[model samples]
Target: SELHEKVKLHYNNFKGDPKDVKEMKERIEIEDE
Candidate 1:
């Protein structure tokens, strides 16, 4: 569940940053493919 853990860490770091979360989401999606 590495991806899950990465998501959790991203959440922790992006708690108050929607911009960062969005960027991270895009990066994660790219990595997923």
Candidate 2:
């Protein structure tokens, strides 16, 4: 959970692009599976 939060924060700081965020989330989901 901490890692996820940190990643989200990092991403938010660098690229606050919704599309990229969504894509990253999707990639994370796939990795999780």
Q: TM per model?
A: 0.56, 0.54
Highest TM-score among the candidates is held by which one? 1
> How does model 1 score by TM-score?
0.56
What's the lDDT for residue 2 in model 2? 72
Candidate 1 lowest-lDDT run of ten:
8-17
- Cα shift from native, residue 14, model 2 (Å): 6.7
Displacement of the residue 20 alpha carbon in candidate 1, Å: 0.2
Whole-model Cα lDDT per candidate? 0.74, 0.70
lDDT value, candidate 1, whole model:
0.74
Q: How far is candidate 1 from the true structure (C-alpha RMSD, Å)?
A: 2.8
- Residue-pair clashes per prediction, in order, are 0, 0
* Residue runs of model 2 more than 4 Å from their true location after superposition: 1-15
